[model samples]
Target: MSLMTTLMLAGGLLLLNGAAAPAETRVDLALVLAVDASFSMEPDEQDLQRHGFAEAFQSPEVHRAIRQGMLGRIAVIYVEWAGAFDQEIIVPWTVIEQPADGPAFAERLLRNPVHRMGYTSISGVIDFGIQQLRHSGLQADRQVIDISGDGANNTGRTVTLARDEALAHDVTINGLPIMLKRPSSLWDIEDLDLYFRDCVIGGPGAFLVPVREKAQFVEAIKAKIIREITDRSNPRSLIQPAHDALPTNCLAGELRRHQPTAR
Candidate 1:
């Protein structure tokens, strides 16, 4: 009854129910775009983030990256997550084979209204991403969860545990750590890049693009998407390395949130 065993049983069931199995779409990648809609992000910041992604998808570069893929297409889903139970799928799995598909995907994405909710559950988002991949009805060369967040996990299970589990299932977890401003809460960990590198991202070719300024958001997302679509091997040069000077406490958020206050 373990997670792995459960997943295996689910896969077996899918195979057994041949008539119920949806036709698997063969693509270069099966990607889950997990965006953060946590309370820490302001309305303006949320707008920026959403527009950045929408613009990236509609760009010529992303289109070219899709065409460069072996199958000339990729399946992607967009999920917005905030609290443990606040995960919502804004876009279901869609195949993008040609340049025209990019705008259509972007249109669908922009049509949805952004929702802001409490808590930052990195673990919840990763777990949700795993579930989406399992039901994606697409046989892809690479399975990736592209998670973008401005804060660390302060709710639900440990982020590292979810990350490790995803890696174990051959799923890569990449990150987009937004460090535009310091969170007002004491729970905010200053070294979010290190936290992401050590606890949030994993598996083959996993890398994070940290957005340090508002102006860089669009470009950062664009670059991240292109690299993901192309399946680049060494992304170290493209992303800033984890700050070795600042030791990352993976449990920093949890500890700060639950710490005993002045009596």
Candidate 2:
């Protein structure tokens, strides 16, 4: 069967055979995990990040969050960002409604090979995310772009320019700022949180969560997922597909939409 057909079957199966999720959900939130693959982040930091997301998807909190959403599921995609044009979609939209669905997705995410494209272009990821969200088939009240990175946007149209454009369309964008030990070289960035707060993150009720240490990555991911899944301030933001990435799918591919323009 086609992937889309499989997804329909999966959603139907989950609703009939799987545990219950919410109904009439307005938001079809898709987390565009905009990660930083810049040269500054060390190998250990990268592993911590990758594993953190994997672990979060497996957590009970995430499961609870999905169950709490009006639609009880969410579609998600992952991207690694560095240069203005260096963004690569590492994961495609997969819905997770049942408890088992979340863990399965997480496992797949854990196994997906790394993409090494490097640049620090937060705006590039946002632009790419806009395209993904626009092309994703589900319709809802809110569109979210969860951008996580360790540096300011030194590339692409100025970060604020891109962010403002997204906000204008009523899209909510959250931020995850990674603050590891400063690098001894140019790749290392300081004041990352401030930079993200001032230039990178924005949207209705947009917020930035700081990853204070490498060890805290997993916890941070869990917290973010909980907030994304459970919060109803933007009832339209609740996703109904279910889980974020666990085991990444190679079948995930970009759709045919004009990319989000960098304003």
lDDT of the candidates, in the order given: 0.83, 0.65
Residue-level lDDT of model 2, residues 1-263, one tens digit each, is: 67854664333211221332233323445566777787657777877888888888888888888777777777666677778888755555566777887787777677776666655677777787787666555455567888887666655666677888888877788888887666444444445565566666677677778887777788887877677666445434322224443432211111101135311
Residue 234, candidate 2: C-alpha displacement in angstroms: 14
Each model's TM-score?
Answer: 0.88, 0.76
Ten contiguous residues minimizing lDDT sum, candidate 1: 12-21
Q: lDDT per residue, candidate 1, 1-263, as tens digits? A: 67954564333222112122345868899888999998788899899999998999899999999998878888778888998888877766777876777788789789999988888899999998898888766798999999999888888999999999999999999999999987656767787887898889999989888898999999999989999999876724545564477657888878877877601
| Clash number by candidate, in order | 0, 26
Candidate 2 ranges with C-alpha deviation above 4 Å = 1-28, 187-189, 232-263
Model 2 compared with the native: what TM-score?
0.76
